[model samples]
Target: MEESKPMLRLKRTLTKGNLWLYILSELKRGRVYAYGLSKKIEKEFGWSHGLITSYVVLYKLENEGLISSEFEGRRKYYKITKKGSEELRKAKRYLQQLLNKL
Candidate 1:
């Protein structure tokens, strides 16, 4: 069954809002390419926001110094930096606080 437009929009809104946190959490596990990040998120969280969005977020994260990337042969693998880990911790705390309030 197909989801309605409103539900689809809701999903995209929620996923896009928190993609950075998801990426950082996954990268904490190990380095992965942009595509791998998308797959992992889908497998774990059941959210597939699209591959291009992943690349766009990755580029932004790299620029912000939350993550670092390296080219291994031809593939670019990304790993979360210490700053990213710290940010993830903060984000988790904020989320927990929000949940507790509700």
Candidate 2:
């Protein structure tokens, strides 16, 4: 059966928009490598969309300058940038406003 519009939107929001938020939130703690990110999200958030999806989001975030990465030997670790913190603050405010309205 086909999904409803709201359900589709929820799926998209959770998978994409919120994935970005979650990644940024986790990075707030400290730097984490790609493989470790998947595990950390699953443990902290109780859900993960797999490594491929996380990597895609990581690449987009890096490209947008929301996060930066450094090589630790063969592994790459990611940390949030100043711009990323500002964006996260904006998102928090937006979410608070939306919640208040609800």
- Per-residue accuracy of model 2 over 1-102 as CA lDDT, tens digit each: 999999989877875568999899999999999889888888997776778989999999999999999999999999999999999999999989998999
Task: Show the colliding residue pairs in model 1.
Answer: none
Q: lDDT tens string, model 1, 2-102? A: 99999989777767777988999999999999888999998998877789889988999999999999999889999999999999999999989988999
Residue-pair clash count for candidate 1: 0
Q: Which ten residues in a row have the lowest lDDT in candidate 1?
A: 9-18
Q: What TM-scores do the predictions have? A: 0.87, 0.85
Best by TM-score: 1
Each prediction's total of clashing residue pairs, residues at least 3 apart in sequence or on different chains, is 0, 0
lDDT score, residue 83, model 1?
A: 93
Candidate 2, superposed: residue stretches over 4 Å from native: 1-12, 15-17
Off by over 4 Å in 1: 1-11
